[model samples]
Target: MVQKPTLAAVTHQPLARWIAYLNAVITFKTPQGMRLTNQDLTHQGHTVRATICHVGPEPADGTMLYLHGGAFMIGDLRMYRHLVARLGQAARQRAYFLHYDRAPEYPFPAALDQATTAYLALCTDPAAGPISLVGDSAGGNLVFALLHRICTRDLPRPAAVAAMSPVVDLRMRAKSLTTNRRTDHLVPTSWARRGCTAYMGSADPMNPEVSPVLGQFDGAPPCLIQADETEMLADDSRAMAAALQAQGVQVDLQMSKGLIHVWHLNVGRSPEADASVAEIGRFLRGVTSRETV
Candidate 1:
């Protein structure tokens, strides 16, 4: 079974409301060799809270938003600070961690709307030049959704997009859900099914707005996808890559063996995680370099 809050417990316990916030606070410590500064931006009549993670004193190559993953319902800026900091160090760029609204209170398009507003604001900011987008899990879903919006609505496209262990199909039709059931412990097909029902609430699972794998990727930016070979959602990344490629979008998909879902979050502790970050950095560099040239 997937590790998550039970409905009965959440309904009875008022303290359950503060769990994500508490986790964010408890896990937050200044990552070694990194600096963090908080910033608040007003966008689309909403207060978008974010943090700028810097690795060095000098200016970075560019700016990229680091979207966190918690099935679109949980997660906070603090929980992802270190990972974003390490990403900043690897990509040679500043990482802006967006703390957007979550679901079941904010449900359906709320998170997507908040993220889109914040990203649009970032694109307009001269300081956050040549922006890119990277995310894991649900955040990866947002990244791809945003890309679809960018293509369909003529919004500014990011320099590149990288998603790790993205939940591309909310319907969970992939065969891996059954085949990798025993191998992938962190996420069970049942948990994802419940999450989709709650997070999507009335939204069609096949809608590109909800399941980005069904979205149009034509004219989208260059993309990179990484997935754990053993995870239930392993095929999510593969399916998304094929969709992007079919739409003529350049894509690179890397499958890592035996790693847990979003193992990149274990950076500084896992060698495999460290290598993944480095590979992402290299991919981003190649994309940005080609864009400039």
Candidate 2:
């Protein structure tokens, strides 16, 4: 069997090159047979890029808004096409892969604001049907941060939400950051901190919008969190689950052993990745069904 390249192996290169490398690999590895279309979402005069992915002839009744993870500094819609399509196919929904602006250049509120804009636009469109949110790594942070924003703004909430290997605590207080440092092949503490710094810019890291673990999730919808037990961000998921439960939100935290961060990216090739996506699809479908009922 050909050995798969670890994220750490390629991330050492320059940002642009690394992103190109991953995109090339993902494009080649993604399973064929999904219809994809580009659609731009505009709200309050701001436009956000989004790609819609679906399978079969008829459109599904709901939307799954996917936020890709690249530590908030990298990642794009192309790299996530496979995962989004598979999840959408699993849940019987048309998935929208959001291409939010990156940090260091765009910074803090840019991505958040764009995400909020896309979500609100989706909420208002009757054709969007019931909407659910799914994000990974930095995107996971957005999922929760967006939830906080929705709750505070008194906006319509998503029917369900899922975060995979999310970086919820920007405080870097999670013990797993040290404990699983060597075990996690995808993210290093120093690299994660750098990404956080780039995304935060002048913002305080502890601000709930920056580090969603610190945010209040009152009235948030049911959430499903999945993380690698041995990855550095494990505690982020654990802590967020506790916090959400305390806030009276229904939370399901699933921890997998011996997997790298955001392993769902390997959906077509890895059994574990396929299983994780399937599980999330089921959770989303179930919750969204209840929401519409």
In order, what is each prediction's RMSD in angstroms?
2.7, 2.5
Candidate 2 lDDT: 0.85
- Across 168-250, the per-residue lDDT of candidate 1 in tens digits comes to 89887999989998898677565566667778988988889799999987678889999988998898999999999999999
* Clash totals, every prediction: 0, 0
**Which ten-residue region of model 2 has the weakest summed lDDT?**
1-10
Collision pairs in model 2: none
What's the lDDT for all of these models?
Answer: 0.81, 0.85
TM-score of 1: 0.90
Q: On residues 64-146, what C-alpha lDDT tens digit does candidate 2 reach at each position?
A: 89988888887866678888889898888888999888877889989989899999889888888889989999999999999
Work out candidate 2's RMSD over C-alphas: 2.5
